[model samples]
Target: MDDRRELPRKLAHEHLARGDATGWFEALYAEADGKEQVVPWADMQINPHFAAWLAAHPRPEAAKRALVIGCGLGDDAEALAAVGFQVVAFDVSPTAVAWCRDRFPASTVQYAVADLLKLPEDWIGRFELVLEIYTVQVLPVELRRQAFERMAQAVAADGTLLVIARGRDATDEPCNMPWPLLHDELKFIETCGLREVSFEDFLDQECPPVRRFRAEYRRPATITSAKS
Candidate 1:
């Protein structure tokens, strides 16, 4: 396996052995220091799908609340802020969060260390847009439902939740590193009371293209939710 891929799984297996599913994130980020490739997902740029979405839509006239799950190096959050979204980007890894702060000394995006399973109560149903790019697929499969539920819950009424992930058929063989998400697993998002807006299963612009799912879901407007 490529070192880019092997290192994370190696660290993950070690942490998982000690009954820690999330700790390896800090271990990997800490070990990486400032080398982006050391942490494979740290491309140090806004995700292309995210960039494309922003291009298609008009920029926010005001500061719309946006959240980035497992923000890694914070490029996505910065991009959101650049487009006038009030962005809050978080990672379970404290080292990664700290690195984001250091990297953007003057950034307005709030970079916090947070766990998806137990998100900040103040964040629930608060964001007008939630970006969960490549976060869910990295976690152990068993944790999928809870993470999806929480991501869904983060969207305010009539707000959008955009999930970008590697996609695999239910029959695909189990893989490593960034494991691909099964289509059926995503249904849980709808169960969390968000309606599917649109879903695209396509290949990205990688050298060797990879299958990806970019799904959008929206919370319906109701009597409440969304505090100023």
Candidate 2:
């Protein structure tokens, strides 16, 4: 297994780079529909920064239900379970969902094949915690905003949302496919009504240059209890 930390940037970003158009996803996923190695979610692991952040930001005791967007092979979802969250992760590709289920058969993680932008309306407001990692970047610019809105709508009131994604600096290279979010672009998520909790940057430049923006946002707690 190639450690995600050691893969070339092109390898890690291949699917997104190849899937640049709004309709490119269907074809990409279709090609991978039944393949096993097509989606290597397990290969993408939590780095020291993410692990440390998870250490301090405990999953809410009341938040037993969680939804993970674009969960590859359930690595992060498994991490969530280890922290007492009941997780349901979804990916656009059936290959990814199948890979995730097989990867964690004995674990409590659940995965489905679904398109994020066209998710069922009932899914809205259903999750106490929604985890978005690298999905928005895969989308075309025209669709990213709408996809982000859907992600925001999934969070339950008094719940939390966490995003782990590649970010660009002012001097970053031009990106088309797998377009990394610029600082201002990320700030746009704030308009969705999620209160910003904290944001941190994780920089790893071993083989595949890894620079991540790990952000936390919370849905408002109206009751204002001691826990609040």
Alpha-carbon RMSD to native, per candidate: 3.1, 5.0
What local lDDT score does residue 155 receive in model 1, on the 0 to 100 scale?
A: 96
Residue 199 error, candidate 1, Å: 0.5
lDDT on C-alpha atoms for all candidate structures:
0.91, 0.71
User: On residues 1-228, what C-alpha lDDT tens digit does candidate 2 reach at each position?
Assistant: 243322323443564456544344344435556553543333456545456767887566764788988876668888888898888888876766776776678988778877788876878888888988877876656777788788888898977888877788878886644567776666777889788889877776547766778888888866655763
TM-score of every model? Answer: 0.95, 0.77
lDDT of 2 at 217: 85
Which residue pairs in candidate 2 have backbone atoms (N, alpha carbon, C) closer than 3 angstroms, thus clashing?
Answer: 41-73
Q: Return the top candidate by lDDT.
A: 1
lDDT for model 2: 0.71
**In terms of TM-score, how similar is model 1 to the real structure?**
0.95
Regions of model 1 farther than 4 Å from truth: 223-228
